[model samples]
Target chain A: MFSGLSAFPLTPMQHGVVDEVAFIRLIERLADAGVDSIGALGSTGNYAYLTREERARIAQLAEKHAGDIPVIIGISALSTRDVLALAEDAQKAGASAVLLAPMSYQPLSEEEVFGLYETVAHNLSVPLCVYDNPRTTHFEFSDELHGHIAQLPNVGSIKIPGVPAAPDAASVRIERLRTLIPSHITIGISGDPLAAIGMNAGCEAWYSVIGGLFPQTALAITRASQAGDTQQALRLSERLNPLWALFSQHGGSLRVIATAAELQGLAASPCLPLPLQGLDKKGRQNLARVLDELSLT
Target chain B: MFSGLSAFPLTPMQHGVVDEVAFIRLIERLADAGVDSIGALGSTGNYAYLTREERARIAQLAEKHAGDIPVIIGISALSTRDVLALAEDAQKAGASAVLLAPMSYQPLSEEEVFGLYETVAHNLSVPLCVYDNPRTTHFEFSDELHGHIAQLPNVGSIKIPGVPAAPDAASVRIERLRTLIPSHITIGISGDPLAAIGMNAGCEAWYSVIGGLFPQTALAITRASQAGDTQQALRLSERLNPLWALFSQHGGSLRVIATAAELQGLAASPCLPLPLQGLDKKGRQNLARVLDELSLT
Candidate 1:
């Protein structure tokens, strides 16, 4: 359940409210596409912007709609009490596992972060994934800290923030991390653009953003890499360079993916929550062209 | 209301709920201390850890108990929708002004951030304080963005993180920022240890954490700096060197300030939101000694 491609679907919002219909459709799509797991309410899902009830409902929806595939629900919050509550909600919703990022408002200390995992991990009935997405959480996990956290109860994986661009360098980075963590704890890679490279370099899982919206494309890259066809994986990834470019130009994948979803009629137009404008007309037009060229939409 | 010493009181919590009684007492103390303004729900107040209902009630409590003093309520959130809601609540609760930090879970672009302030600023009935607190918000505001946001309606101040250590450098830093915005938008300085230096260097206000708890100590420094008695201001700040040392050693001011408040009986013993441990036994002992040595208790 921790390995292979884990697709993350956006919890689409319309007029500042969670669009439940669009969200369930996204789940069924990922489940139908044969993703090994579905990562619900990740950064791409705009989980941070959601209230507890919203997150709980999204977790239940994802768990129910993902069919036989395992679901990993993101349970990150600014406070431990809240994270624990979310984790409980996820477990009760039948989530196979939960993801936690050390989301901070007051910049957290190393001790506080460790304590957060320790407290939550002990209480959790399901497996836990440490989400090390520094871009959003602004909390960098040192390899030493990862090693410590991985040893805690229920910690099944560490979703590292991608590796070096070069294949050999990426392999070396993954191998170094593998040594620190226990064998049972799967090492997954995030950063959509680097998914193919990271999986080819021995990261057991590709926790993907693009996979949520474009599962077949993401699956092709994942399967090729898993089969040791590094060249095929790289080639497929290179084909999606236009999509990656869009992700870069638009400040990460949420807006671009939501834009793609909106354009594809997968979700409502203007799906993003407030304070987060999806894209301007020009960027959306550019995305439309790129999606057309790639045959993604 | 945007200038001089703005004392930021902790919205003290007890067993995961807002300690309204303790919170009210803290506000009344600040009012009695004769602070120029009360900055409720600031980082020191653990505003991000609270619910909208809790924050609204706190804002109302602060406004009502603060007597004639102006109360600046912090209304920052992950989404603009929530921010707008909180802003409306503050206005309804009779807030003199509102403080906003570009809080994020998705790492935002400069354009997105500017759009946030632009959207929130225009909707605000009360004047807005641009909370440039990179340490907490993890979103650094460039001077150009500050200048741009300052031009928006209701933007009355920019609460900068801090200035350079040296007197000459601090003045240069503040002066450069001064040129970026209109004179009506006062430049307030945070980073409690540097309050004296930044205020003396030309900051119109000290958005102080320590001021919330120990009003007399903070006010003396603020008054001296405003009176051009830089030597006296610096001397008073230097006397609190032990306190500053604790802040540096403990990551930042929130934890240390919370610990101080807990020891002083200003709030509950474990005042802060969970996942944020105030201090360990040894650390608290050290804090107690420093508080006693400084005659702060």
Candidate 2:
């Protein structure tokens, strides 16, 4: 079973080129901090901006650095054919599993949703995880659709965002999901800075974008949660709350990942692809204040 | 100088491959019907569903069949790099111009929007048109952003959708748009079945998705509009109105184009890439009734 903290590594770029060395270092750093798994080419990783070759290269690097740790490669594309192609590449590159956010724009029917997962599962040699980040995808997978996808051979997990409710309500949803699928199908929660809240609510895994920048802080929270120390996990979450708030602004995940990499002296520039602008003056000031409070600088 | 009707032909697919013969035939048919110009791989043509090679082949086929008619290739992709590559291919395929949509899913800032068009203009050898279809793109190009893009070299036209208001209001927006840019930059309006409404409102061109399926009807409307016979144009539009309604249901443009191609016997099946299911029994029945009413079957 996949449990504990998982880090979605931010893809590094310099002068419009993928920074392989920086990426390797970032993966290694997360692995050293006891991150249970690594996610590459996710929303936080700017998967839309990377070429197919670049994506494969990053997946290979992630696998090499992760060692025994599982690597969940994000296969988010606007077209199903491209998603299947990416899934095949990720599996060949040694990824442990593939996570998919089907069709970023346009609402899809239940049949379409089922077809998407079925195609990916058929094309991929490894297990598949469903990514239900509705905020970006614009289409939510209904409970009925989820149950149908769960019956597929390779679908083993669901990555749900932690927003829209508290742990108790989230726990209820997880229970509902559990009843629909087999016990082997894990429920993973994303979007909560306080990883313990999700873990306590019966989530088998937690994926964090902030974890890439602050591995030790994230690990501490995860360890506290695993040990059933609710107070300690909450305390860590409170301490890191300001940083999370800063990163949750305009294109927050992208900005946070880039800023954090810069703080670590890894990426040469905090450049995001077109349509996602970098931090403005006020944003930079806010980030500075957060960094100072965290003693990260 | 662009006026009257424009046609965006379907990229024919046969046996899971791009059917270049059918695609060329479709374009030639449109050109013979006196279409002012031809647009390939727009939303009406399922632009996102195609591979790079497939898209390139379709563009080349359009140019080949277009002969003396201007062929404007659609360069729509999630990444700036991919879109630029498409623009370069379009130029090589003998396209007279290219149209670009903004980044998919990720909302861009005004500055980022300008940057995208600026990059395209600087690198692209052919004249570039900015396509503003907020319905599909999910983000509207601000008047300010449009102004900045128009100032860039080689930026030639603006393609605005006809919905959310009537032709008069759209014409007013274009008039205001013209003040901020060079007079050489023409404004084209898409989404109206009748060509006269947009043409009378000062738009230089009218792009019709329905035209590919009904070239004779589209030609009649175009000829009537160009000759200043508004009554005849309106009559033809009324006949075409029911067909437009059939095409506008459930996933709209993509479904419409696919269905139209199938109706014309251009392709054996209407295939949609993953996450977009084929039309249901009710949809097919509705389309059949409309086609029968219009004597298009």
Candidate 3:
């Protein structure tokens, strides 16, 4: 299953269609940086915004450009049937595994949530990673529910979203989760700001959004933290703090990261799907200054 | 353009597919009971759980069986492009208006929310209704934002969800909204339990879920309330309190209403999309007892 630093790339778009060439370039950069895995269509990738056909195309492009790196396609949907459908499509598209999130229109009971993962995992030939991001899904999974899902067949990993404001709390949460879940189930931490703390707390991987844009920086933090070099890891994370601060202020990093990519000329104008505005002038200026300070420009 | 009681039908499902036959029967019942309009693919319709193709097909069914009753199609999507696409399909299917909700994976700012309606309303030939349901969309529109949306060229109405426990508060909210928005832009109240109060408080229409299942009863309440027959309206609503209590307890009436339809032998089963469980045994027993007491079965 997905391990180490997994780059969750932004699905670059042109006129509401996925720009495959730009997407390929993004993936190649991650592969070139020696990132361990690629997660296409993750939340940062705007999985819910894209159409079904566009999603399939983006997964295919990510897989093709990933080379030897494993590609984990995000297969979150409102229904179990749609999740299963996307999982099958991901497997057929050569994805190494599929990430499942409990995205619901209605509030789901604990039993229903478990049924969603168990039913989808039962039908999939590829390994299934439970994506526990309550911020996006609005359905919180208790430690007891997480333990139940981990014991299910074909469930291989869990992508834990760290609490950005409290890195120490994230470390404590991951530590608690590690003890509760099966030993074989890999624990990967997301939330760019807290990745270092999660790694130091014994998370096996970093399922990262910014890594897709700055894989070198993300990889450096993981390598340093994993080698027990806490000082070096702290220094690297401190350098990234300016951008992380903007992410926190905006309540999300999608638009800020997209703006960062555009400002650095890595991609075209930072245009997201309509109704979702990209960074304003103030946000762009703030992001540009941070990128310059980090020597990333 | 829609006024009076508007029936919001449940998109009856057989396995994973929308059961068209059952859907038509549901609409025909509303038309026969003299409902003023029809809103298909609403929240009760499980619009998010359905595919684009299924949604389009359901709109066509609703229009066909609705006869001359104005059909307002629910056109909510995460992306503006998808919302526009669905809106166009709805227009082609002979819809009178389209309902738009600020449905996003990420929480949208007031600017983004306004832009969603402005962009969609720009291209639509029919009227557009702002569907402000924070519980489902998680994107709340302040009174200022609602006024902004109301001023859009093609925006004709706003569907306000009632505060179930406080019908007086729901009525006062509608009265405030009515004064803020254009006189021509009608304010309709949803939340079936409070429909009677909304009607009495001068709301132009009832965008109802239970009305789709029990149209005759819903119409009677509307007619009584609209004629300034407060006592009659209160008596009618009192008769339906048992069912309304269950709806309130569930936080939503979709599953309960679906169960009521099944209990009355309208649909085959009370199936929601996977991951959203149907009523448990206790809920079912409570619902059955209510239906029996109401003489609905």
Q: What is candidate 3's CAPRI-style docking category based on DockQ?
A: high
Count of clashes, each model: 0, 0, 0
C-alpha DockQ for predicted model 3: 0.81
lDDT (Cα, 0-100) at B29 in candidate 1: 89
Clashing pairs in 2: none
Looking at candidate 3, what is the lDDT of residue A176?
A: 85
**What's the CA error at residue B103 for candidate 1, in Å?**
0.6
- Residue A153's lDDT within candidate 1 is 93
After superposition of all CA atoms, the RMSD between model 3 and the true structure is 1.6
Q: Quote each prediction's TM-score.
A: 0.96, 0.93, 0.97
| Candidate 1 lDDT, B1-297, residue by residue in tens | 888899999988898889999999999889999999999999888989988999999999999999999999999999998999999999999999999999987777788899899999889888999999887777878899999999999999999999998999999999999999998889999999999999999999999999999998899999999999999999999999999999999989888889899999888979989889999999999999999999852
- Extract clashing residue pairs from model 1: none
Q: 2 or 3: which has the higher DockQ?
A: 3
lDDT per residue, candidate 2, B1-297, as tens digits? 245567877776665567777777788888777777888888767677787888898888888888788988998887777888898888999999888888466566677777788888899888888898876776688777888888899988888776324666756766787788788888777875535576666677777776765667777877876787767776777777776676565655567656656765776575555566556777767776777777751
Tell me the tens digit of each residue's lDDT in model 2 across A32-82.
877888888888888977778888898889999887889999887877778
Residue range with the least summed lDDT across 10 consecutive positions in model 3 chain B: B162-171
